[model samples]
Target: MEQKIEKLSTVKIQKSPDVYKVVDALNRTLKEDDLMFGLALDEDKEKMVFTIYRT
Candidate 1:
């Protein structure tokens, strides 16, 4: 008899402000190939936040 195997995958997501400085900083700090999959800006609070994960 024969068996089958499954492969694994990974993903990353991040959120940040719409400001040029923040975005530029994030880009500069992060790796070139690193992915910026998600983004969210809080205009009311006037702040930039970021979220990153891998799976």
Candidate 2:
């Protein structure tokens, strides 16, 4: 299956072990509002990239 998502915003944040907890919470809390959250590592593999999408 193929799906396309729209990018709303992207931010660089300090890498933290518990960052995913926040992302998961956001997804569970606001999914009904058509918003999605994602977390990933930057190219340097030091900082984390947070992205919000409109689904």
Candidate 3:
């Protein structure tokens, strides 16, 4: 069997209001598309970045 890797895209939210809130919203809103791949926090820049895989 052949395995394929999906392309990923990153989105940064500067001065994010709430990390958990954003994650919850994304999970809820994008559940159908299943776009969310992962999330990370940039302490230096004080930003939250989300990695989404192309579907």
Candidate 4:
């Protein structure tokens, strides 16, 4: 179960309540493709940072 995750791209998005849902869905749907999604909060600007990774 050793995997190397590499950051592909990242973008700042407007905060959304369903962000977690989106990330979960992506992880489930794309796991077979070696793709992972992550979400981070930028509290200072009240924004969501979405990052894509390849394993």
- Top candidate by TM-score: 2
Deviation in angstroms for 3 in model 3? 8.4
Whole-model lDDT, model 1: 0.43
Ranking by lDDT: 2, 4, 3, 1
Please say which candidate is ahead in lDDT: 2 or 3.
2
- For model 1, residues 13-50, the per-residue Cα lDDT tens digits are 23333445654566566636453322345555445444
**Tens-place lDDT digits, model 2, residues 1-55:** 8767899999999999999999999999999999999999999999999999998
Off by over 4 Å in 1: 1-18, 36-55
Worst 10 residues of 4 by lDDT: 40-49
Root-mean-square deviation per candidate: 10.2, 1.6, 3.3, 1.6
lDDT (0 to 1) per candidate: 0.43, 0.96, 0.70, 0.94
- What TM-score would every model get versus the actual structure? 0.28, 0.90, 0.49, 0.87
Q: Which candidate, 1 or 3, has the higher lDDT?
A: 3
Error of 2 at 50 (Å): 0.1
Q: Model 4, range 1-55, lDDT digits (tens) per residue? A: 8878899999999999998998999999999999999999987769999999999
Q: RMSD of candidate 4 to the true fold?
A: 1.6
Clash-forming residue pairs, model 3:
none
The whole-model C-alpha lDDT of candidate 4 against the native structure comes to: 0.94
TM-score of 2: 0.90
- TM-score for predicted model 3 compared with the true structure: 0.49
